[model samples]
Structures are given as structure tokens and as C-alpha cells.
Target: MSSAAAAVSAKPANSRSRVLLASLVGTTIEFYDFYVYATAAVLVFPHLFFPTGNETTALLSSFAVFGAAMVARPLGAVFFGHLGDRMGRKTTLVAALLTMGIATFLIGLLPTYAVAGWLAPALLVILRLAQGFALGGEWSGAALVATENAPQGKRALFGTFPQLGAPIGFIIANGLFLIIAALLPSDDPSRPSLAFLDWGWRIPFLFSAVMVIIGLWVRLNLVESNAFEKTVKTGQVRKVPLVTAFQNNFRELVLGTFYMLATYVLFYLMTTFSLSYGRAAIDAAVPGLGYDYTTFVLMMIIGVVFFGIFTLVSGPWADRFGRRKTLIWVTLAIALFGLCWVPMLAEGLVGVMAWLIIGFTLMGLTFGPMGALLPELFPANVRYTGSGISYNVSSILGAALAPFVAVALWSAGDGSPFWVGVYLTAMAVITLIALLLGRETRDIDIEE
Candidate 1:
């Protein structure tokens, strides 16, 4: 190639690399900040915040608070989506980083129930809502930044770059928790490590400041997405992206919401619900595996390692095979995997390990292509708004209630995991139907 041609090509290629890097870094922090709460909810919040309840009640209440974030995610979607579609992905994402950073760091500084009583949980709810709001705009912008800047025919591969942040975030958050959990010592008949609950947990939330600073540095260096730039150049940027998305892109919006359901439901069931199930005291009023916290969390981290690897692999497969086809098949695998939940968890730690590996592998396969598929469903003018709405709406429909619902389902089944498995399979089927009926996004011109 001529020097001039190579230079021009190299510019976009380099920009795409930066977009992917920024997306990975920013989303890693976003999810790390977010999942730190999920981890804490299971590990400490019940004991620290809701001291008034039985173990069952305390765990349920913490999950209730955890789920509350999903309630506000759609609102964040609207607010940030508007800013993203109106202003630009870069500015909106940077703002999201700052908002999440400030909120999460504040969470570390909050007093526990012993010091502040009911006020502690109340403040936690407020901060969790803020995290939801920040994430509302973060995912769409990151996905669009990566996918829109992607080279032709490789949108799925590029899109998965941002999705990789999920597993990476999971690893970091869980690894830190595990390390800190180890420092505090385990509960024993003679002496217990109340330190983990007393103050050790706060260390994770407090550390979010560092993650935010790093994320902001990377995001600040990023340019606006090429798709948004072209929309601006064409003078076709919508005056009201949210409204335009609803009016013009309703079908794709709906399809994208259902398309995400399988991923969200399976994710929480694997990560959050399983933690509760595994860590419960077997002889307690409510039955659980009674595993140690650090061990179970370490297992979860190992499973997430596989989750991270498959996320990268799914990108290339989605690019080659098409998003709809990949989703339908991988979701079927999820359904099959769901049916094995009872048998696997029944196997003790080994079974639990098997279940998580299978569940997370399937989660990666279904989740990876979303960054490309969601954005491709909308026009550039409202892509942020449409994808944000659909993605967070799915959160409400899927994850917001998953742990709470799974617990309820487990209770309703008389302590069996059967009903939860049915629920997962049902969600996968719904997602499969959504994919079959939705647009074949792989061939869609992103520039459209």
C-alpha cells in the first residue's frame, strides 16, 4: 500500500484500538463498582445493615437493596442516553465515570447499622441508585464506541472487547473480596472474624476511587465515536434521542430488551444467587451448602476466568456466524445448562464448580455479541437512546428480580433448586424466540 493510504488506514485502526481500550477500562471500573455491592450484599450487608432479621430475612433484605438498583437503571438509561445521543459518547461516559466514582467512594465512608441504624441501609440504597444511573449511560456509550469504530464485518469482535469488562470486573471485584475475606479469618466456634463484616468490607468500596481515576484517565483520552461524528456531519442528530428512539426504533428496542433477558437472568443466577446458596449454613433455618465464603468466592472467580475467555471468543464467532444465529444456539445451550443446575449443585463443591463453569461459559457466549447487536438495531442518531433503554429495561425485567425471585422460587420448591432451573430455561426460550423473530443484525450496515 502507498504511504498515504497506509497512514489514513492506520489512523482509524489506532482510534479503534483506543476506543476498545477505553471501553474495557471504563466498563471494568463501572462493573467493579457495581458488583462490589452485589458481593457485599451477599457477604456483609445482611449482617451489617439489616441486623433486625433472621439469617433468611437479612439475606433477603440485602438482595432487595441489591435489586433496587435495577429499578433505577432504566431511568439512568433515559438520562444518560439522552446526553450520549445529544452531546457525544465520550463526554457522557466521562460523566458516568465521575458519578459512579463519587457515589461508590461515598459508600465506603458510610456508617454501619451500629453507628447509624436504619439510615445506613437507606443511604446505601441511594448510592446504589446512583451507580445504576451512571451505568445506564456507560454501557451503550462503551459498546458504541467500540462497535462503531470497528472495522467492517468485525463489529461483533470489536463489540466483545467492551463486554470483556464484565468478567474482568467480576474477577477483580471477587478477587479483592476473597483476599480481604482471607485477611479477616473464618468463623469458628471459639473465635470468629467479625472483622470482615465490621470494616474489611469497606475496603473494596473505598478502593473504587483508584479504579475511577484510572478509568477517567483512559476515557478522557478517547474521541467521540465515528458513528456519532458522521451523524453530526450529516446534521441528522436527533433533537430528542429518547423520543426519536421510541417513535422510530420501537421494534428493535423491544427485540433488544428480550434479547438481553437470557444473559441477565443467567448471570445473576450464577453469580449472586449461587453465592447465597453456597454460603448458607447447612443447619440454619433455611438450607444451603454451608461452604466457606473465601473458598466459594475463589471458585466463582475461577469460573469468571472462563467467562472472560469465552467472551473474547464469542466476538469472532458472532462476526462470522451472525448475531441472531449465535444467540439462538448459545441460548439453547444455556437452557440445557439450566436443566443441570439441580444435579450439579447437588454434587457439592465439585458440582457447584461444574455448574458455574457451564453457566458462565454460556453467559459469555450470549452476552458477548450484545455490544454489537444492540447498536446495530438502531440508527446512529438514536442508537445510544434505543440501546440504553432496551438494555436497562431488560435489567429490570431480568436481573432486578432474579436473586430475589430465585430465592423465592427456591423456597416455594421446598428448598429444591428445580423451580429456579425452570425459570432460567424459560428465560432462555424467550430470548431464543426473540432472536428468531428479530432482525439478522450481522449484515446490517452500521452506517445506516
Candidate 2:
């Protein structure tokens, strides 16, 4: 090889700190942006964006808009996935972060239903779609970056750093809201102060711009992964990665999508549905746990602390075992946890807290390994497109509808959460079956 070619080939891998930080920070910002919207969808949007005469109708409408974003995620995967495969993970990641940050920042500035009439909701949905679009590309790229650069036998452990972003983001997003709400104290604990409903919620959304800036700085410093560089050197980069992904790896696409089904459902149920269910008034048409919003969020934050801890723990377990085996045991536990939702949720504060802790712990286990597993399903040339499509498509199947379905089931059961638990169990079964049908990805050669 020419001296110049040799130098290019022999370049050292990204420093471990740089790889982990780039992956972790970008997803932290992305999930922070997403969780901010989720918290608002429950606490603020129904009151402002969809001011229907009835509370249930208003909440459902708000959730509908929240779910609408999932529809855009797959399209985002294709668009940004193509770019990641064709250009580089670094540039595509920057674009996704900017897109999500701008959308979230804009959400803070939007007029409410009273001021903008129908235009208010229209703008909200538009921005939500943009958020979904940006996120579609974000997770898969971050996963690829981490796992692709991972030291031998430690890919799953490296993968957990990115997965750590979800819990960290949830904590930060909800923590800001809690602080803001405290500042704008309410006369009645049951209802938000008018000032808070009017303005306090926007701070978290606006604050996302600062995070986006940091994420961009970290990502811009990232050199393309050695694996991706090899694809380029070997002339293996596909001109149309999305098409090639589907044509060549159709089975993996299907399996990966369903493989994530339980994790997505459990996560949204734990975070979004639980927030609404926990905080709704006891005397309302559909009674709930009757805790105030601030109290319930605090409880969730406590549970998410376990979520973060278990996320770190899961990586080593998956590495020691295999991803499929670790996830199988975790997935089974998730199914059993679903069955316990009703009894646990009915037992009042202790029960509810136990449920949250257990559920989020399982969420951590299932989610952490995916940062390695999904990227391992495809070769370097099409890994971005294939994995992005699977992850986002599962978002559509699992997350997009989980809150909506749980709400419907909650109402269907006359405020009982039994049916919602059943729904979770059902999704878990699908995921377990998918896991059983698929091969262990722990040993796969992702660079090929």
C-alpha cells in the first residue's frame, strides 16, 4: 500500500472516552427532547393545545398528536439512514440533533389553542412530526457509533452508555419540570398554577437548545468508525441503503422490529401512561391513584434511578451471557411483571412505587442490549438503514400506540388498569417469540 493509504488504514481508533461521550451525549439530548414532549403531552398540552370541553377527550386528543409523531419516525429513518450510510454517521447524527432541537425549541414558542385556534394544534403536530423524524435517525446512528468502535468482547457494555441516555434524559426532563412547577406553586395541589400551565412547561423545551449545542460539539469531533471506514475502503457502501437493507435483510428487519416491541411498550407505559394515571383526580369520571403531579413525578424519578442503575448492570450481564439469552430472561420477567400491574397498582403508594421500580428495571435490561443487538443484525454498508428502520418501526408499533391503548383500556376497565397490564403482557409475548426465533447477535461480526 502507498504510505498515505497505509496511514489512513492504520489510523488509531477513536479514544474510548470520545466514542462513549459522543454516543451518550447525542442520545441524551435526543431523548431529553423526546421526554420533554412526553411530560408535556400529559401535563400541559391537553390544557393548552386541545381545549376540548371534556377532560378525557382533551387528553386523548393530546395523545393522538403525541402518537402522530411516530408515523413520521419511519420516514425519518429512511431519509437520515440513507445519509448515515452514504455520507457518514457523524454528519447524519448532527443533522438529526439539530432537527430535534429546533422542533423542541419551537414547541416552546407556539401559541395555545385560545390564541391560534386550529392553527395551534396544527403547528404542534408539525413540530412533533419533526421531532419524530429527527429521532428516527438518532438512536441507530448512536448505536452504530458506539458498537462499531467498541473494543473486542465489550460491544454490549459500550452499548449501555447510549442506552443510559433514556433514563438520564427522563430524570433531567422531569426534574426541570418539577423545579419549574415548584417555583409556580398552585393554590390547589390537584391543579397546576395558571402561571405554570401558561409558561413554566416551556422552559424544558426551550432548554433543549443548549443541550443540542453541546451534543453537536461532541459529535462534530467524532471521526467515522473504523468499520464504516472499511466499508468505504472496500467499495462496499451502497448507493441506496434503505432499498438494499430491505432487499437483503428483510428477515432481520422484521425480527428486529418485533424484538423491540416489549421494551417500547413497557417504557411508554411506565413513563407516559403511569404519569397520567397516577396524577388524575380520584373523583373524576375515571378515577386514578389520585396523587398530585409533582408527587407522582418524584416517585417516577426515584424509579428511573433504578432504571439507570439496571441499565448499566444489564450490559455486563449481556456480555457475560449472550444478548439473546439475557434478553430472553428479561423478557420473561417483563411478561410476569405485566401480570402484576393490577395488584401492585391497586395497593396504593407502596404498590405503585414497587411496580414502577420493577418495571423500569426490566426496561433497562431489555433496552441496554439493543444498542448492540440491532446494529449487529446488518452489515456495515446497510447497518444504519436496516437498524434505523427496525427501531423506528417498532416505535410505531409499540410506543406510538402504547399510551393511547393503555388509556383506552384504562377507561374500558372502568378505571381499572387490569386491561392495560394485559396489553403489556401481550406485547411481551410477541417480543419473546421474536427472540426465540432469532439468532444470538452477541457473536455476530457487525463490521462485515
Query: What is candidate 1's lDDT per residue for 382-443, written digit by digit as tens?
Result: 98889999999999989998999999987777677888999999999999899989878888
Q: lDDT for model 1, on a 0 to 1 scale?
A: 0.85
User: Which pairs of residues collide in candidate 2?
Assistant: none
State each model's CA lDDT, in order. 0.85, 0.92
Best of the candidates, TM-score: 2
Q: Which regions of candidate 2 deviate over 4 angstroms?
A: 1-12
**Candidate closest to the true structure, highest lDDT:** 2
Q: Candidate 1 — which residues are off by over 4 angstroms?
A: 1-14, 189-192
Mind sharing the TM-score for model 1?
0.95
- lDDT tens digits by residue: candidate 2, 382-423: 999999999999999999999999999998888989889989
